[model samples]
Target: MAEVAAITEREIELISRFVVLLKDEQDALKRADPSVLQEIGAEKIGLAEQLNTLEADRRLALGITDDQNTREAMAGWLAQHPEESTAAVNWEKLLELSREAKQLHELNAGLVAMHLQLASDALTILTRQSEQHHALYGSDGQAAPVSGSRIVDSA
Candidate 1:
């Protein structure tokens, strides 16, 4: 039962913000087309790698490197053995993906807003129909033969 050390105040705050952003992204993602989520998720993995780099540096600086965490140590080794490495970090690619991710996020928000509006309109219509049914059918479930265009909000 090894307990993880408490995060620093700054880390805690950053994590809180990250969690909020992720949740917002998820909510926005719900109303988005599958392609939107797919593109964003793909870009997010790259951003995640960038984040991992920072985390690795922080871990080493704190002398918390564990031998079992081989991959975590690989980044450090890569720095020392540049000639031996074949992979490279493309800042431009990262930047492009980040831009695409941001765009997808914006699109997701707009879609969610549209969906919410549609849901609200649908609910209002249902409510009105139910009220009309109550008036015509006298309580129990039944439809009323009435039709009209109703606006939920005046704006």
Candidate 2:
């Protein structure tokens, strides 16, 4: 029980850190800073892996198998050990933080998508303009106007 409580507390702390990182990521996305975003992405991945390990440890402490219903098992454990109110509160806070992190991740994805679309549109416009310009000019730096008129028809 004590181990479970301790693990829950650790999870809460880690999750709080994760939420802070998510906020940083959001700001980076807003600023469109590729280098900062890349760094934050790596850090987020590391924190996520650590959180997964902590979750497994917490489950093991509760004697809940992988196939078991984790939420139900946690609730049962909390019910049986009413003295661990701190753990229960921490668990709730962890859930809230997880939800917040997920939301931030989704928002960041949307921002990335928007940025990609804008780039694609700009590229398309530039390509079309280049093609139009090439159609009006030959490779020898001579104008090949499409109006079927030549400046030197016999030369």
Candidate 3:
């Protein structure tokens, strides 16, 4: 029998959302306040579990779940019916699937790098603006009366 090949739109969307949410979680973990780290950590873990469950469901729906169990069951069936015996499943298909999966992961990693770059650039711009404002303001834009010294902290 020919193999079934199908993936649902909902599954694809779920996977995409999971990737984006995971990226956000990682970014937030790095930048969140110390007091809120626990909340961020718990939320990330829960989102990860949801992603795993969705992926498992997708794999099962694709009829490609439980490779070891399938192999064992097939072996038993073949042994029980010698006349219907067929050669072992072609593993090349599995390899192809693995390669596709790796490609998707690479794509995801690239997206994460892009997000980081954009965030870094924004922070750089904001820092420069703040520095400019502070410099021109002369400490709240207050001019020193007559003669006075302004102290700047190196720290």
Q: For residues 108-145, what per-residue lDDT tens digits would candidate 2 score against the true structure?
A: 88989998998999999989876664366556888664
Predicted candidate 3 versus true structure: per-residue lDDT over 34-84, tens digit per residue: 465466457646755764675465455434556646445444544554553
lDDT of each: 0.49, 0.83, 0.48
**Candidate 2 vs candidate 3: which has greater lDDT?**
2
Off by over 4 Å in 1: 1-89, 133-155
The candidate with the higher TM-score, 1 or 2, is 2
Clashes of each: 0, 0, 1
C-alpha TM-scores of all predictions: 0.35, 0.81, 0.34
Residue clash pairs of candidate 3 = 137-141
Better of 1 and 3 by lDDT: 1
Measured over all alpha carbons after superposition, the RMSD of each candidate to the real structure, in angstroms, is 13.3, 5.0, 11.7
Highest lDDT against the true fold, candidate? 2
Deviation from native of the Cα of residue 56 in model 3, angstroms: 18
